[model samples]
Target: MPIQHINPPGLLQFDAMSQVVVASGGRTVYIAGQSASDVNFEVVGGNDYYAQSVQALRNLRTAVEAAGGSVENIVSSTVYLKNLTPEIAGRFLEALAIACEGKSFPPHAFSLIGVASLAGADLLVEITAVAVIDAAVAA
Candidate 1:
Protein backbone atom coordinates (compact mmCIF):
# COMPACT_ATOMS: atom_id res chain seq x y z
CA MET A 1 0.00 0.00 0.00
CA PRO A 2 1.14 3.49 -0.81
CA ILE A 3 0.60 6.33 1.64
CA GLN A 4 0.10 9.81 0.24
CA HIS A 5 1.00 12.95 2.17
CA ILE A 6 -0.79 16.18 1.33
CA ASN A 7 0.87 19.56 1.46
CA PRO A 8 -0.56 22.71 0.00
CA PRO A 9 1.50 25.47 -1.58
CA GLY A 10 2.10 28.99 -0.30
CA LEU A 11 2.05 27.86 3.31
CA LEU A 12 4.34 29.36 5.89
CA GLN A 13 7.79 27.89 6.20
CA PHE A 14 7.31 26.94 9.84
CA ASP A 15 4.50 24.56 8.92
CA ALA A 16 6.16 21.17 9.27
CA MET A 17 3.06 19.00 8.90
CA SER A 18 1.27 17.52 5.96
CA GLN A 19 -2.27 18.67 5.38
CA VAL A 20 -3.55 15.10 5.49
CA VAL A 21 -2.66 11.46 4.98
CA VAL A 22 -4.29 9.04 2.58
CA ALA A 23 -3.53 5.37 3.05
CA SER A 24 -4.67 2.79 0.56
CA GLY A 25 -5.68 -0.66 1.82
CA GLY A 26 -3.85 -0.79 5.10
CA ARG A 27 -4.42 -2.23 8.56
CA THR A 28 -5.40 0.26 11.22
CA VAL A 29 -4.26 0.00 14.81
CA TYR A 30 -5.66 2.12 17.59
CA ILE A 31 -3.50 2.10 20.64
CA ALA A 32 -4.93 2.84 24.04
CA GLY A 33 -3.72 5.93 25.83
CA GLN A 34 -0.27 4.96 27.00
CA SER A 35 0.94 6.50 30.20
CA ALA A 36 4.23 6.27 32.09
CA SER A 37 2.73 3.36 33.97
CA ASP A 38 4.47 0.04 33.66
CA VAL A 39 2.81 -3.30 33.00
CA ASN A 40 1.71 -3.39 36.65
CA PHE A 41 0.04 0.02 36.15
CA GLU A 42 2.46 1.69 38.48
CA VAL A 43 3.41 5.21 37.44
CA VAL A 44 7.01 5.56 36.27
CA GLY A 45 7.43 9.27 36.82
CA GLY A 46 6.31 11.10 39.93
CA ASN A 47 5.23 14.62 38.97
CA ASP A 48 7.90 14.77 36.28
CA TYR A 49 6.69 16.01 32.93
CA TYR A 50 9.73 15.31 30.75
CA ALA A 51 10.38 11.86 32.17
CA GLN A 52 6.75 10.87 32.00
CA SER A 53 6.45 12.18 28.43
CA VAL A 54 9.44 10.12 27.34
CA GLN A 55 8.14 6.98 28.95
CA ALA A 56 4.72 7.50 27.46
CA LEU A 57 6.20 7.84 23.99
CA ARG A 58 8.27 4.73 24.51
CA ASN A 59 5.17 2.82 25.56
CA LEU A 60 3.30 4.13 22.55
CA ARG A 61 6.12 2.95 20.26
CA THR A 62 6.02 -0.52 21.77
CA ALA A 63 2.27 -0.79 21.39
CA VAL A 64 2.38 0.38 17.79
CA GLU A 65 5.31 -1.83 16.84
CA ALA A 66 3.71 -4.87 18.45
CA ALA A 67 0.83 -4.39 16.05
CA GLY A 68 3.28 -4.50 13.09
CA GLY A 69 3.84 -0.75 12.76
CA SER A 70 6.71 1.50 13.73
CA VAL A 71 6.75 5.00 15.12
CA GLU A 72 7.07 6.30 11.55
CA ASN A 73 3.69 4.78 10.77
CA ILE A 74 1.90 6.89 13.35
CA VAL A 75 -0.72 9.00 11.64
CA SER A 76 -1.99 10.87 14.64
CA SER A 77 -1.23 11.41 18.30
CA THR A 78 -2.92 12.90 21.36
CA VAL A 79 -0.97 13.99 24.40
CA TYR A 80 -2.39 14.66 27.85
CA LEU A 81 -0.58 16.17 30.77
CA LYS A 82 -1.39 17.26 34.27
CA ASN A 83 0.34 20.61 33.77
CA LEU A 84 0.50 22.29 30.38
CA THR A 85 2.38 25.48 29.68
CA PRO A 86 4.21 27.13 26.83
CA GLU A 87 7.47 25.76 28.09
CA ILE A 88 6.02 22.33 28.70
CA ALA A 89 4.53 22.21 25.22
CA GLY A 90 7.86 23.19 23.72
CA ARG A 91 9.48 20.35 25.58
CA PHE A 92 6.96 17.91 24.25
CA LEU A 93 7.44 18.92 20.63
CA GLU A 94 11.19 19.01 21.03
CA ALA A 95 11.19 15.47 22.32
CA LEU A 96 9.22 14.17 19.36
CA ALA A 97 11.30 16.14 16.85
CA ILE A 98 14.43 14.65 18.23
CA ALA A 99 13.04 11.17 17.85
CA CYS A 100 11.82 11.68 14.29
CA GLU A 101 15.10 13.08 13.00
CA GLY A 102 14.05 13.87 9.40
CA LYS A 103 12.14 10.64 8.93
CA SER A 104 8.72 10.54 7.29
CA PHE A 105 6.19 9.71 10.00
CA PRO A 106 2.66 9.61 8.61
CA PRO A 107 0.60 12.73 9.19
CA HIS A 108 1.87 15.24 11.69
CA ALA A 109 -1.54 15.69 13.29
CA PHE A 110 -1.18 15.81 17.07
CA SER A 111 -2.49 17.54 20.17
CA LEU A 112 -1.32 18.42 23.64
CA ILE A 113 -3.81 19.10 26.38
CA GLY A 114 -3.62 20.00 30.05
CA VAL A 115 -5.66 17.98 32.46
CA ALA A 116 -6.36 18.09 36.15
CA SER A 117 -4.97 14.61 36.66
CA LEU A 118 -4.06 11.40 34.92
CA ALA A 119 -4.87 7.74 35.68
CA GLY A 120 -2.60 7.86 38.72
CA ALA A 121 -1.26 10.51 41.02
CA ASP A 122 2.35 9.91 40.11
CA LEU A 123 1.74 9.92 36.38
CA LEU A 124 2.00 13.23 34.59
CA VAL A 125 1.75 12.44 30.91
CA GLU A 126 -0.21 10.07 28.68
CA ILE A 127 -0.19 9.67 24.93
CA THR A 128 -2.21 7.79 22.32
CA ALA A 129 -1.55 7.25 18.62
CA VAL A 130 -3.09 5.63 15.56
CA ALA A 131 -0.98 3.86 12.97
CA VAL A 132 -1.61 2.48 9.51
CA ILE A 133 0.33 -0.66 8.66
CA ASP A 134 0.69 -1.97 5.16
CA ALA A 135 -0.99 -5.34 4.96
CA ALA A 136 0.81 -6.32 1.77
CA VAL A 137 4.17 -5.86 3.45
CA ALA A 138 3.25 -8.45 6.03
CA ALA A 139 2.53 -11.15 3.50
Candidate 2:
Protein backbone atom coordinates (compact mmCIF):
# COMPACT_ATOMS: atom_id res chain seq x y z
CA MET A 1 0.00 0.00 0.00
CA PRO A 2 1.56 3.22 -1.19
CA ILE A 3 0.17 6.48 0.12
CA GLN A 4 0.83 9.47 -2.05
CA HIS A 5 0.75 13.01 -0.78
CA ILE A 6 -0.19 15.55 -3.44
CA ASN A 7 0.74 19.22 -3.15
CA PRO A 8 -0.38 21.09 -6.20
CA PRO A 9 1.24 24.33 -7.28
CA GLY A 10 -0.24 27.73 -6.40
CA LEU A 11 -1.75 26.28 -3.27
CA LEU A 12 -0.24 26.27 0.19
CA GLN A 13 2.68 23.86 0.41
CA PHE A 14 1.27 21.36 2.84
CA ASP A 15 3.27 20.64 5.97
CA ALA A 16 2.32 18.01 8.49
CA MET A 17 -0.89 17.92 6.47
CA SER A 18 -1.40 17.72 2.77
CA GLN A 19 -4.08 19.28 0.61
CA VAL A 20 -4.82 15.82 -0.70
CA VAL A 21 -3.76 12.49 0.74
CA VAL A 22 -4.26 9.50 -1.52
CA ALA A 23 -4.32 6.45 0.71
CA SER A 24 -6.60 4.38 -1.50
CA GLY A 25 -4.17 1.52 -1.39
CA GLY A 26 -4.85 0.31 2.12
CA ARG A 27 -7.02 0.19 5.20
CA THR A 28 -8.45 3.38 6.61
CA VAL A 29 -8.68 3.67 10.38
CA TYR A 30 -11.20 5.99 11.93
CA ILE A 31 -10.08 6.71 15.45
CA ALA A 32 -12.66 7.84 17.94
CA GLY A 33 -12.53 11.35 19.36
CA GLN A 34 -9.97 11.59 22.14
CA SER A 35 -9.55 14.11 24.92
CA ALA A 36 -6.69 14.87 27.28
CA SER A 37 -7.47 12.10 29.68
CA ASP A 38 -5.08 9.72 31.27
CA VAL A 39 -5.35 5.94 31.50
CA ASN A 40 -7.76 6.40 34.40
CA PHE A 41 -9.99 8.65 32.35
CA GLU A 42 -9.10 11.62 34.50
CA VAL A 43 -8.59 14.76 32.54
CA VAL A 44 -5.03 16.06 32.40
CA GLY A 45 -3.68 19.57 31.69
CA GLY A 46 -6.57 21.33 33.30
CA ASN A 47 -7.06 24.91 32.11
CA ASP A 48 -4.14 24.62 29.72
CA TYR A 49 -5.11 24.00 26.11
CA TYR A 50 -1.53 23.37 25.01
CA ALA A 51 -0.98 20.70 27.62
CA GLN A 52 -4.33 19.16 26.90
CA SER A 53 -3.66 19.10 23.17
CA VAL A 54 -0.37 17.38 23.84
CA GLN A 55 -2.07 14.76 25.95
CA ALA A 56 -4.75 14.31 23.32
CA LEU A 57 -2.09 13.83 20.67
CA ARG A 58 -0.47 11.21 22.82
CA ASN A 59 -3.74 9.37 23.08
CA LEU A 60 -4.11 9.54 19.33
CA ARG A 61 -0.64 8.11 18.92
CA THR A 62 -1.41 5.25 21.25
CA ALA A 63 -4.51 4.33 19.32
CA VAL A 64 -2.77 4.59 15.96
CA GLU A 65 0.15 2.47 17.05
CA ALA A 66 -2.16 -0.13 18.50
CA ALA A 67 -3.72 -0.40 15.07
CA GLY A 68 -0.32 -0.96 13.48
CA GLY A 69 0.04 2.58 12.22
CA SER A 70 2.09 5.64 13.07
CA VAL A 71 1.11 9.21 13.63
CA GLU A 72 2.54 10.01 10.19
CA ASN A 73 -0.11 7.81 8.69
CA ILE A 74 -2.86 10.06 9.95
CA VAL A 75 -4.41 11.80 6.96
CA SER A 76 -6.99 13.97 8.69
CA SER A 77 -8.16 15.12 12.08
CA THR A 78 -10.65 17.41 13.79
CA VAL A 79 -9.87 19.25 16.97
CA TYR A 80 -12.37 20.49 19.53
CA LEU A 81 -11.45 23.37 21.81
CA LYS A 82 -13.37 24.41 24.86
CA ASN A 83 -12.13 27.98 24.73
CA LEU A 84 -10.71 28.98 21.39
CA THR A 85 -8.22 31.79 21.19
CA PRO A 86 -5.33 32.87 19.02
CA GLU A 87 -2.76 31.99 21.66
CA ILE A 88 -4.44 28.68 22.33
CA ALA A 89 -4.42 27.81 18.65
CA GLY A 90 -0.76 28.70 18.38
CA ARG A 91 0.03 26.71 21.46
CA PHE A 92 -1.88 23.72 20.12
CA LEU A 93 0.05 23.82 16.86
CA GLU A 94 3.29 24.22 18.77
CA ALA A 95 2.49 21.18 20.82
CA LEU A 96 1.54 19.32 17.68
CA ALA A 97 4.80 20.24 16.01
CA ILE A 98 6.68 18.90 18.97
CA ALA A 99 4.59 15.74 18.87
CA CYS A 100 5.49 15.24 15.24
CA GLU A 101 9.07 14.71 16.40
CA GLY A 102 9.87 18.39 15.98
CA LYS A 103 8.95 18.24 12.32
CA SER A 104 6.15 19.93 10.41
CA PHE A 105 2.95 17.90 10.24
CA PRO A 106 -0.43 19.28 9.40
CA PRO A 107 -1.95 16.07 8.08
CA HIS A 108 -4.14 16.02 4.96
CA ALA A 109 -6.80 18.21 6.54
CA PHE A 110 -7.97 19.46 9.90
CA SER A 111 -10.96 21.26 11.34
CA LEU A 112 -10.80 23.09 14.62
CA ILE A 113 -14.00 23.78 16.52
CA GLY A 114 -14.79 26.15 19.36
CA VAL A 115 -16.95 24.36 21.82
CA ALA A 116 -18.66 25.28 25.06
CA SER A 117 -17.39 22.18 26.72
CA LEU A 118 -16.14 18.68 26.24
CA ALA A 119 -16.99 15.40 28.05
CA GLY A 120 -15.83 17.00 31.29
CA ALA A 121 -15.18 20.42 32.74
CA ASP A 122 -11.50 19.67 33.17
CA LEU A 123 -11.02 18.70 29.55
CA LEU A 124 -10.00 21.46 27.16
CA VAL A 125 -9.44 19.52 23.97
CA GLU A 126 -10.55 16.48 22.03
CA ILE A 127 -9.29 15.14 18.72
CA THR A 128 -10.75 12.70 16.24
CA ALA A 129 -8.53 11.33 13.50
CA VAL A 130 -8.55 9.27 10.32
CA ALA A 131 -5.45 7.41 9.20
CA VAL A 132 -4.29 4.90 6.66
CA ILE A 133 -2.51 1.70 7.65
CA ASP A 134 -0.31 0.26 4.96
CA ALA A 135 -1.01 -3.44 4.59
CA ALA A 136 2.64 -4.38 4.57
CA VAL A 137 3.31 -2.21 7.56
CA ALA A 138 0.44 -3.71 9.48
CA ALA A 139 1.78 -7.14 8.74
Best by TM-score: 2
Q: What lDDT would each prediction earn against the true structure?
A: 0.71, 0.80
Give the worst 10-residue stretch by lDDT in candidate 2.
130-139
> Pick by lDDT: which candidate is best?
2
TM-score of each: 0.79, 0.85
Runs in model 2 deviating more than 4 A are: 100-106, 135-139
State the lDDT of candidate 2 residue by residue for 28-111, as single tens digits: 999999988998999888788888888899899899999999887787889998878888788888777776556655456677
| Per-residue alpha-carbon lDDT of candidate 1 for residues 1-117, written as tens digits (9 for 90 to 100) | 765655667753234355565665788889999998999998776666766766787788889889988776777778897778888886666556544434323345577889988
lDDT measured at residue 39 in model 2 versus the true structure, 0 to 100: 81
